[model samples]
Target: MGFTNENAGYIAAQTAKRFLDAGYSVRGTVRKLASARPLLEDGLKEYSQAGKFEVVEVPDITVDGAFDEAVKDVTAIAHMASPVSFFFKDPEPVLHAAINGTKTILNSALKAGPQLQTVVYTSSITAVKSAKEPHYVYDESDWNDYAEKEVERLGKDTPGPIIYSASKVAAEKAFWAFREEKKPSFTMTAINPVFVIGPPLIAPKTESAVGETIRLIWTVFSGAPFPLPVNGFNFTVDVRDVAALMLYIASSAAGGPQAIADILRKELPETRGRIAEGNPGKGYNKEYTVPDGEIDINSEKGKALLGGWIPYEKSVVDTAKSFVGLV
Candidate 1:
């Protein structure tokens, strides 16, 4: 279950579809039933006939006990809600929402007790890769030092991206802390995906960080800017793949957070060569640098859960195709 509709992007929608595909009912949280219905309707249209999806209104995720009622009797939760935006005048709000919203859900889940066996959280690659510096190889073991520093020094004047990164780091950290403190019976898994790019379940009208990533490829296809690739943004995974990975983790009775995180780490780069091959050649602007590192996500636990990742080229192609329809 997602925390709120507005925060639930393509990833959340796609993850919900995976659950429905597995013959499970999905109950997503939203601030307003009216606004969220159209999006949910579009995303889960195929499942509507099966009557597997519903929405619960939790207008304020930061409020204590906000998710208490919504989580009751739920077997699993995909906590795919977090405030992310391109424009935030101050970092405090973003930090507060991400950190507090996660705590609120964990608290409610504790109250949920026995029925909640798995809690899957949507974490970002930023949580693992320090965006400030290029690491040769990053894995589930690395927590972004840059983000940790931002969280330590969070104030009114932090940069938007840093704040966003820190929010992710803080939230994930909070989840682990809560898990240790509360020691709930449920299994906790966190899926740390890179800049996810693929055809959205429902197309968005406005540009977002995700939309911009799609546009970057289009910029190359159209030969608009014959310049260089944007710096430090080399990695990406398909939204659908990320969704499927989450589903696999949630469905796996023995799956834990590290196993889930490790699977993606081990498999994403295997598809890296395809990214360059799929590119139109013009898309490879020299300005940006590709990440350097070999992450071995091939643990026995990860292998038991799933296979390889979705091809990067396929994800970019699908994203470009979707962008054409958007404009």
Candidate 2:
């Protein structure tokens, strides 16, 4: 489920593909039925023809009972609908939308009752990291409560990045709190990813974060000044891997590490770079380092829940290849 046709296509299309491959029918929600082109792309049309895929229109996700009908017979929910662009002038609306939209879905799920087993929400690394202070390492236990307070202090004037980070924090915090308060029968899990980058299922016409990230690398190939951030590196994950993780969690049994009902971290790469090494302005900006401890990709939990990490290098290559002529 997503706001625009293109915004959620990358992960949504991939998630549907994973389920279709496993012989499970999918009922996805879209804001506008007319704009849902990505889901019908590739061989999904065949799945639709076979009656394995269907989409219901849910124009407003923040409204109560928005997903009541969508969840009627479905066994699971992948609540991926959230704002991506941080260009909004005011933070309150974004915060409200994030918190309220999540509540609306969970409420509908509760109304749907026992059939719904799990809900895998797409969270972000923003929910875990402290925007003001740098940490040596971060894990599932970390929460971005500081960022939420920062947003409250600054209100509408909060920076786009801060508001965007706080939105995730607020939404995820609301989810856990709702689970504790409501104690609904279904299990809930969050896949907290950082700067998702990979080949989109369908290449987008307008430049998006995924498109722009791939374009940044193209600048290096053309010998343009590719400004590699000198301060800190963002942890990155392949979109495919994140979608697969969602599927694994949604379909897996109710026990093991997932039984604890906590947020699961996506695998991280060792380093980050877009352009050539030793560029003129590489080390000039000394903001602070964003620390990440190594994720045990081979650990029992990871091995059991996710198809192992897709290397960032491959993600970069595939992203570049996907936009070969368009970019």
Deviating ranges (above 4 Å) for candidate 2: 1-7, 41-43, 131-135, 206-224, 247-304
Q: Model 1 — which ten-residue stretch has the worst lDDT?
A: 249-258
lDDT of 2 by residue, 193-292 (tens): 6556667767655544345324444444323454544232234567777777853211111111111111111111211232233333232222212223
Poorly placed runs, candidate 1 (over 4 Å): 1-5, 131-135, 151-154, 205-212, 218-223, 247-304
lDDT of each: 0.63, 0.62
* Residue-by-residue lDDT tens digits, candidate 1, 177-265: 98899888999988777666677777655544345445555444332433343344545567777777863211111111122222222
lDDT of 2 at 286: 24
Clashes within 3 Å, all models in order: 6, 0
